[model samples]
Target: MANPVLLNNIDHKDLHVQTGRGAMFGDNVMSALTFPSEFRDIQACYPIVFRKADDGNFEAHALFGFQEGENLFLGMHGWEAPYVPLTIERQPFLIGTNGTELMVHVDLENPRISSSDGERVFLPHGGTTEYLERVNSTLLAIHQGLQQSRGFMAALLEYHLLESFAFDIELDDGSQYRLAGFYTINEERLSALAGAVLERLNRAGYLQPIYMVIAAMSNFRTLIERKNRVHAAQC
Candidate 1:
């Protein structure tokens, strides 16, 4: 459970947050929410896919492993991937709404937070620290990106461009894991789109991310290699 509270200099002046990657820091995630704004970087490392929400809406995710709580990118050292998703990077801090204003909220229960070590939340003089400034930027980016993604996903759904896929992955040791319930772009549908429809998607700025999601499937092979290395090490 999260004990989120509005961040303030008086209450959180001495607060600090550890920025490290490990299971201890709650970094053992199979996937993280992603948006079109981050597709370029996310596509380079993770397989970008879509999943149907409980509300029947679609959302994008950057897959890290085949099962829940299994992050192949995590190791004894740190996150193996070059790009960490913004959703993961924004841990322990979140944007809270005060009427129409966005305020920063801190999760008191998060393991990353402390008062004696790591990056400080505020300066002694009651101003934001550099670390907090970066957090603010990350939160803002997430806010904007998520808002844009809703419409982008809606368009994809409207055009029937999203398709579900399942994969039975075999490791070097012959262990098999079947991945399911994830969605990807239907390249055939996209390619068959009418010129006018393509123009509309292009004008809406959804084309690039669409292609990026397709390109990200290539990283599945990389993920398989990482999974193989993990399995071999445990053997």
Candidate 2:
């Protein structure tokens, strides 16, 4: 469970966050929630898929692995990919809105949270540290990206562009895993879209990301290779 609290210089002046990636620090995720704004970078390294939220609403994500608590990108050397999702980049920090103002909240239970070492949250003079400033900017981007994602998802739903799909993987060890309950854009429907509809999507700034999602499906092969490498090493 997360113990989140509004960050304050007075209470957290000495707080520090350890920077790095690993499962112990909560990096062992099969997927990370992502927004259309990040499609380009995410597509370069991950398969962008859709998953149903608790309310049955569709949300986009960048898949990292096939099983629960698995992240093929994570290895003894750290994240293997050149691009890490912002959703993963923002660790131990979350955005909260105090009225109209956005505020940063820290998760106290996170392993990255420290006091004696790592990146400091505040300077010796009680001013915001550069590390905290970067975190603030990242939180703001995540907040805004999520807000825009809602409209993007709504448009996909309105056009009935989403389709349920499954992934059946046969590893080198002759073992198979069936991944289900996920969604993806229907390429047939996308290609059949009327010119006017395409133009509307383009004007809304969702067309490119839709294509990015499709292109990202190719990364499934990349994931399989990574998984095979890990399996081989274990063997």
Candidate 3:
């Protein structure tokens, strides 16, 4: 459970946030919620896929590992990937709303929260610190990016571009793993669309993200390699 409170420099003046990456800080995960805005960066390091949320809405995710609670990108030194998804970076904090105004809220119980060490939330004079400013930016970006995803998903559904996929992996030791319950953009369906439809999608700023998602599929090989390395080391 989250103990979220509207952040204020007064009550939380001495608070600190540990910015290091590790499972202790809750980095272990198979995937993170992603949005079209970061698809380019996400595609470079992780495979972007879609999954149906409990609410029955499709949500985009940047795949980090094949198994549940397994994040191949995370290591003892830190995250191995060239880019960490913004969703992963924004920890211990989330956006809230006060009527028409957006507000920043901190999860008091999050492991990243500290009092004596790590990045300070407020400066000595009771103003936000650089770390807090970046957090604010990250939160705002997430807020806007999620809003953008609604229309992007609507466009995908309109064009029937999403298709379910299953991946079967065989490790060096002959261990087999099956990744299911994920969706990807159907290239065939996308290619078959009429030019006017394509133009409409492009005009709506959804085309590049579509291509980015397609490009991200290539990173599955990287993911497999990482898994194999982990398996080999375990032997």
User: How big is the positional error of residue 232 in model 3, measured in Å on the Cα after superposition?
Assistant: 1.1
Any runs in candidate 3 off by more than 4 Å, and if so which? none
Model 3, range 1-235, lDDT digits (tens) per residue? 7899999989999999999998999999999999999999999999999999999999999999998999998887999987989988989899999898999999999999999889999998998898999999999999999999999999999999999999999998999999999999999999999999999999989999999999999999999999999999999
Top model number, lDDT: 3
**Candidate 2 local lDDT, residue 144:** 90
True lDDT of residue 125, candidate 1: 95
Per-residue lDDT of model 2, residues 53-120, tens digit only: 99988899999999899999998988989998988888999999879998889999999999986899
TM-score of each: 0.98, 0.98, 0.98
Clashing pairs in 3: none
Please give the CA lDDT of all the candidate structures. 0.94, 0.92, 0.95
Question: Pairing residues by index, what is the TM-score of model 1?
Answer: 0.98
Ranking by lDDT: 3, 1, 2
